[model samples]
Target: MERLRRRLPPLTALVVFEAAARLQSFTLAAQEMCITQAAVSRQIRQLEEHLGNPLFIRNHRSVALTTAGQRLFGAVDESLERIAQASTEIRGDASDAVTIAATICMSTYWLMPRLDAFQQEHPNVALRLFALDREVDLRAENVDMAITCGSEGQRHGVRMAHLMDEELVPLCSPAYLAGRVLREPGELLGERLLNLDREHWRGFNWAVVDWAAWFDHMQVRGTLPAARLAFNNHAQQIQATLDGRGIALGSPRMLADLLASGRLVEVLPQRLNTRRGYYLAINEHSTRPRAVAELQGWLERVSHAAMA
Candidate 1:
């Protein structure tokens, strides 16, 4: 048994050897495995040592497998491929769970409000929400779906569905706007402007929207006072605006409740189109499971209704 244990190659070494042998190039195998070519060479050497045979003949710029290496590669490659196919099939048929990734502010203000309805409608579906600001790799993260804010660009193997075009409008506490009668967008230049800090505004390059951008977009001239207070989260910024702190550039959906309750009022009717917008993303390699499909449908419906 001890001799057999010594004869057996480590799983990592086997994986490296199989990849290198099949591709006939350590460099290509390293690229596929996301490791250095040196690492792949070391692993294959270790694998050869375990089997007590030299696996490959290293030429000036290429490697060719030995007769024994070719035989082992054929068996190992087929075995690993079968294992991968089985795992994928099993994961696809998993019926009890669905995982979704969304931003913190969207999860808090948007999804949380409507998720109960989804639960009640689809009682058997166990839903998990991962609230994060950073974009997650759907396949790598095992996420069934994700909601992201940005322009659609080079997402390698993901399908993107446009959710909505986000528009930013100036908002302030109703009390703050009550006595002060500012007719046009220019008037807001004199009032205090509250800025949501850089973290929440990542990918939004317009510093003018950070008090400077909004004013510039409105074509308002003249110097303005610095931001009265800066918040890392939109929720806090909205709360401050509600408390009559200052005017803020608010997302139409984020301040829906405050607008309905008359706590916040639109400072200007004109809205600026932001470069960023919300989107639904799914892995192209995987079909949407039933629960994930249902959730996606529900989100689209809710977003459309909100916009309407």
Candidate 2:
């Protein structure tokens, strides 16, 4: 035990040092590791002390690696990367598959339809999908990849790729909207407004997509009937709208099939841009397996084609 301790620095210190060296910022490394900046600095200091050399030269408001630090970082990075790669290879052999976490609506409305094509292209890869509403920790959950709706602004230790920009518009069955004199946005006041109470709706700013924002955006005044039925799930709200329950603010991509099938109609042709858009997030520490890499490539290609 004593010999081991003498031969090696603490794993925490090594990890902290590696992250700081890779990102070139102690603060960012701290954020990625879910630790304080001070803690990261202390760990790096400890690592430098153990090695009997200065790792970083403190410049004004920034840091630069010393020659010894650069050499050490290269060795440490390669070693850690190899360990991660080996672990992923071991895990991949058991399942020989990729696991993707996505929202229920995305899975049902978007991915399910195109899954056959993906399978056809990569027959050997098994794609397992988890349809969920809540955000998951990829590391803790063992999720290979995840597609979620958000701006890639503040996420750390995850590689985020922008998929598509989503536009929201009010929609209802054409039969339901027929004979309802709706010349202006204010006319929606008398209509039943189905509510989708999800995280995506947070940016609506009116607490609900009521007549207020719609009318305000259209430069009109209107009142909407109190929500008769509210659903926390977007799929449920959309399904309710399809059944002619009420008008719902629908995502263009989510309701594309229903609209094409004549099961639903856009109440207003004008689309509203929301703060959220679909993003592909991969955990930084997790090595992308062969199947996962293939799926990620397919998703990027398909999403880009749809947008184009």
Candidate 3:
């Protein structure tokens, strides 16, 4: 303990550094830490000085971590998560609330619709859904579990289970397809397409199938048509599709209810399997262990039913 106190940089500075490094933006780190951008910068500078290594490559509009920065961040983030978990356990939190984080589209289109059954089954457990368009630190955010789309792997202090593979098909409102005879992929060139911007999705590590990728997968050989509508997130793009604006690539498993209800229609018999999959990640040291376990079991059963 004495050695740690002497050797470790200030915990506050480490917190600021971790936020800035994880976010890759001093301004965002400041906003999250509830401090000024200058304060964040100063803490980062002090930490770098303490470690005798440059931590960040400051850019005109952004920041990138130096190798040293990445290394420190990996250690700091995991350590903080462990500390937080230990503290929570020590406190013996008695809340029965279970929080699950997921992508906005998955929450809105898939999980939200099916939550009633779970609620009915366990009336005493309160469920909170944290829906965001971007990935988040599950332990840092105090999320008991998260449904994410990515390759299967162990994240820091988290256990992951494969939920389902993402299956995409061309979808549009029935009104949009009424007048169009899209017998082949090439015929789609004439129609207005709704798309999620690939550039916007890069940071999230999502498996984004842009128009070019979809066209190439379908073996359509020509200059693909420009998207008439591009959304920064899936929810907006899906809304536009539902409003009969344009056709979009969407998951059949996630939107199965919508398709069955005739709110949307599949445009082609073929499908694109992006090879990416949705995963359920649970914080192994959650305070509400029983609640988390119950939700995890329910999610696995529901997802398996969907895939079946």
TM-score of each: 0.67, 0.69, 0.78
* Residue 30's lDDT in candidate 2: 92
Clashing pairs in 1: 208-212, 208-213, 208-214, 209-213
Error of 2 at 170 (Å): 0.7
Candidate 2: stretches off by over 4 Å: 6-88, 91-94, 178-181, 198-212
Count of clashing residue pairs in every prediction: 4, 0, 0
lDDT per residue, candidate 3, 37-143, as tens digits? 99999999999899999999999999999999889998998788788878877776446478899988899999999899999998888998899888877767788
Cα lDDT, all candidates: 0.78, 0.78, 0.87
Best by the lDDT measure:
3
Q: Candidate 1 on 46-105: residue-level lDDT in tens?
A: 888778899999998899999989889878866775675477677764564677888777
> In candidate 2, residue 11 scores what lDDT?
86
Which portions of model 3 miss their true places by more than 4 Å?
1-83, 86-95
Higher-ranked by lDDT: 2 or 3? 3
For model 2, name the residue pairs that clash. Answer: none
Task: Give me candidate 2's TM-score against the actual structure.
Answer: 0.69
Error of 1 at 68 (Å): 24
Name the candidate, 1 or 3, with the larger lDDT value: 3
lDDT of 2 by residue, 1-308 (tens): 98987799888899889889877889878998999999999999999988899999987677889999999998888787677668767777346567788888888888788889999998998877899877766754667788887677655456788888777888898778776646656677778888865455565322344445655677765555786888877778878888889888877776667788888888878777766688888866555456677888998998888768
Off by over 4 Å in 1: 1-95, 199-209, 285-288
